[model samples]
Target: MNETFKPGPEAVEIVERESCFRGFYRLDRLRLRHRLFAGGMGPQISRELFVRHDAVCVLPYDPQRDAVVLIEQFRVGAMDKAANPWLLELVAGLIDTDEEPEQVAHREAEEEAGLQLGALWPITGYFPSPGGSDEFVHLYIGRCDSQGAGGVHGLAEEGEDIRVHVWPLEDALQAVKDGRINNAASIIALQWLALNRAEVRGLWV
Candidate 1:
């Protein structure tokens, strides 16, 4: 790391950009170059970037019951590499225009799992993929009452048919170890819970 060479948006220069595809999601072609770590700017190159709205994901955990609510959905993106395309994931939704990330978390939890979440604990915010996609995610663990939080719920108009699952906290963690819960956001949240379960429980209980 250089003392004066800071890494920021200004370090990258977008020479030219054009929309490549736009439908549900978007794609853009960019010719760009950026400041190099060793010395000067890297060579100008072409790249196709996947464009998507910033999104939010919340894992609903019941501190009293020591359980977590997760959802299973068909992910077309995973079809090529995964043995089973349906992924067990946190309740998630895109941050709509004028909608706060926390609001999206609460809304998706109810929409996908029938659970009205309590106070949301910030887990971490990250880019699920930065190499090729502009998909930033805000992750959270929302305290909830998971008394009856299992179902098949999703918006039909959006063609979503999601299956909700309530797992004991340990089981969810084990699923991650067993490679069952392979999605990035879910993996990150569950790992964080595994490390900070007691403190997180104290936040609600």
Candidate 2:
């Protein structure tokens, strides 16, 4: 939800009840302080949310082959929001309490695509959705063998049914433009690859 509010000494009311559901990710129910205008000062408002989430997205670049591995799955959140349920996304997962982002990336790659990562090229460490959630994703481009290591793979117990595809680097970028790939992480990863394709391809996969 794209919302804007103004800040003043005005009082805010919890017009509705707030609740939270804790799962792999937590959902927070909020009744805004009130809808006040920022008065042309730009949208400025603070939230009471303080969540810490660690995630990783694998680019899965293959230098010699000029390919990348990606996974497709049905996203419930998107369906709930009236968006397309099936989504093309990068290999990603939330970091458990003790795991590092890099380790999570590698682990997710194997779990979702059955590929072993070679070298990892880290992009940036930032928040994915900051307004309401304290979620953050640690982005990385990992080199891996994409010859015959990609296809359908996922943990059935987790209700995950993922389809892995080994895509030519250029075709993947084209898919991004054509809206065939419609997930934030996937879009960002592809754009990053577009800008750094030469350098990424120079490295051994």
Top candidate, metric lDDT: 1
Scored against the true structure, residue 39 in model 2 reaches a CA lDDT of 33
Where does the lowest 10-residue lDDT sum fall in candidate 2?
Answer: 38-47
Q: Itemize residue pairs with steric clashes in candidate 2.
A: 6-36, 6-37, 6-38
Model 1 residue 150 CA deviation in Å: 1.2
Tell me each candidate's TM-score: 0.95, 0.77
Q: Can you give the lDDT of residue 122 in candidate 1?
A: 92
Question: Please, what are the lDDT tens digits per residue for candidate 2 over residues 58-171?
Answer: 788888888888888998778876457888788998887698899998899989999898888998877877876677889999988788876689899988899988889899
Computed on alpha carbons, the lDDT of every model, listed in order, comes to 0.91, 0.79
Alpha carbon lDDT at 79, candidate 1:
99
lDDT of 1 at 176: 95
Candidate 2: what lDDT? 0.79
lDDT of 1 at 166: 86
